[model samples]
Target: MTVVISAIPWLVVSLVGGAAACVPLYGGNVRRFLRSSLFVKVVMWVPLFVAFVVAVSGGLLTGLVSGVLLASIGAIEWLRRDTAGRTRWYLALFVASCAVWPISTAQLAPPLWMTYCLSSVFSDVTAFFFGRYLGRHRLPDWINRDKSWEGVLGQLLGGVLGVLVLGMIFGTAPTLLAGLVIGAASAIGDLVNSVAKRIVGIEDWGSTIPGHGGVIDRFCSLNIALAAAVLLPR
Candidate 1:
């Protein structure tokens, strides 16, 4: 039952992610870039990391491996481009935070990890559908025009619903307010990433994820949302 409940969102995200990436409305370049982004983001990374976790026990060793691996990759990318002025400190902070997520999950309780994933994944998933289907007004067309108030609605509903369902399956119910807060945090994370991308002058983070850009692109919301959850009063 736990497996089934958790899987529901994973499947939904994959389907929605694929659509968001390859949809013809965006343009040929979008489809071309995002087509690979979706699968790599959803499929390759988590499973690969999970296997790594299993091997290293997702503890200190895992953190060390993840930090070194991510930092090395970031360094390689930086070297390849070699444009120091274009890169910002926040981008480095973002990458560092990505390393934190796996470490946090390895160290923290299962519920907290699930909270972060539930909020972030469902928010993105529902936002895609809501923005595409029901969205009429684009609230902030600055970085990502597709993000709408209506999509925010979907994120809220989906986040709340996803948390409640997870709670039910686990026989532990968090406050509805907590769910709302998580949803809001997830939205803020997404917005921040959008702004970061614009400032960095990149469409997606990298082609690492086939359709999603890179680990940084896909994991930004989860990292910030997790931090917010830690800071927020329960």
Candidate 2:
């Protein structure tokens, strides 16, 4: 609990920053750079390596490895003539590191944390696919078309279900609230990412997650949501 409370804000800021950075990499101009073989290699491998390190280790080691990876990616992005896909790989890598470190350390209370993580995952999964398939009514033109009221509803339902189940297992209002807030926050976070990407004229963020795109692509919403859960009143 102490660790969670202390880490929440830092985590949120980092995740948000990383997500915002991805805009340049995956959004509107992606094709201009992804066409390059080097850009493809960076996007695919750098972030994954960062995630793996963070997952296996915590503390300074995680930070150190992540920093080095981000620096390398940033330098490459800057130097490479194809500025289009340049930031995508580094942004994806940074988000991956942010997510994996906390989750790996959160194993302290495996059931509770895992429940929280799983619930978040389910909510995001449902919302993403559902939004893509069923969405027709559009958001305000200012907001990304990718996000919809339908998706938010799906997220809310999924979050509520996740909280109910996890709450039953944990038998605590704090735990239940944590799940709810995190799920909602995660959905909001996703919107935040989309908005940022749209503002910068990017698309998928990065290609780190295979079908998913980037780490921010996969976990941006969840991480922010979970961070909110940690800070909320128990």
Candidate 3:
């Protein structure tokens, strides 16, 4: 109805941009970041997601904000002395992917939002542990020294678990499939953003997001995962 109609454009844009990012990923770097900061960041975001569900019921376009919330990461490109086509591509795809989930909420109901966002969070949470505790094999140093097969496995496990739980809580049966898609997509999106960070010669996207770095640093993978959910039916 009204919601679905309004959401189509963002969905189309998200799928297109996310597809563009699906390349033979080289890998991701073992990034340096503050552990305490990460903890604070998660603590803050969890409530926001919960509030988002409540807000959706009361009619707020928080989804639109979700879609573009991380687009500001593009600003760093201006700081680069050697900007290239990569900058433009990353900026476009990043913003488009970020925009998708908001549009998706417009079409779907509150439960879908819960299922999608939680899947992304779980994927990241799992990946971090897997990468830190068990990662040994370094990808091509040029690609990223920090990523490993274990991290990938963790992402899948986490995404699936999150999606399944939310699906059950929300009473959405078919959302189980989201585990496979969102887990993988979110990881790929993270790797893509890692590449962008390397090119710009920086770390943590920015330090403005209160222990999370910047809006982009925190939500890069989430946006990509949300884009995947948008393409998925039910």
**Which predicted model would earn the best lDDT?**
3
Query: Candidate 3 lDDT, tens digit per residue, 1-234?
Result: 243234335434533443233221212221322233443554465455544554455323766654444465545633342255456666667666766755767766766666677678768867876886688876655546668878888888888887776566555654556788899988888888777777766676666556567667667787788778878886
lDDT of 1 by residue, 130-225 (tens): 887789988664667757888878877777876776666444567777677778877877777776666656676665545566556666676666
Q: Tell me the whole-model lDDT of each prediction, alpha carbons only.
A: 0.61, 0.54, 0.63
Ranking by TM-score: 3, 1, 2
Locate the minimum summed-lDDT window of 10 residues in model 2. Answer: 73-82
Q: What is the lDDT of residue 124 in candidate 2?
A: 73
TM per candidate comes to 0.69, 0.56, 0.73
| Residue range with the least summed lDDT across 10 consecutive positions in model 1 | 48-57
> Whose TM-score is higher: candidate 2's or candidate 3's?
3
Question: Which pairs clash in model 2?
Answer: 26-203, 27-202, 27-203, 28-201, 28-202
The lDDT of model 3 is: 0.63
**Which regions in candidate 3 have their CA more than 4 angstroms from the true location?**
1-35, 54-60, 72-86
Q: Taking the tens digit of each residue's C-alpha lDDT, what string does model 2 give over 1-234?
A: 343334334434534543444335455365654574435433443444345334334544553554455444433433342356534654553355454435433432433443465467657755754576567776765568757788877786777677665444443333555656767877887776676566556676565456465545566665565556545563
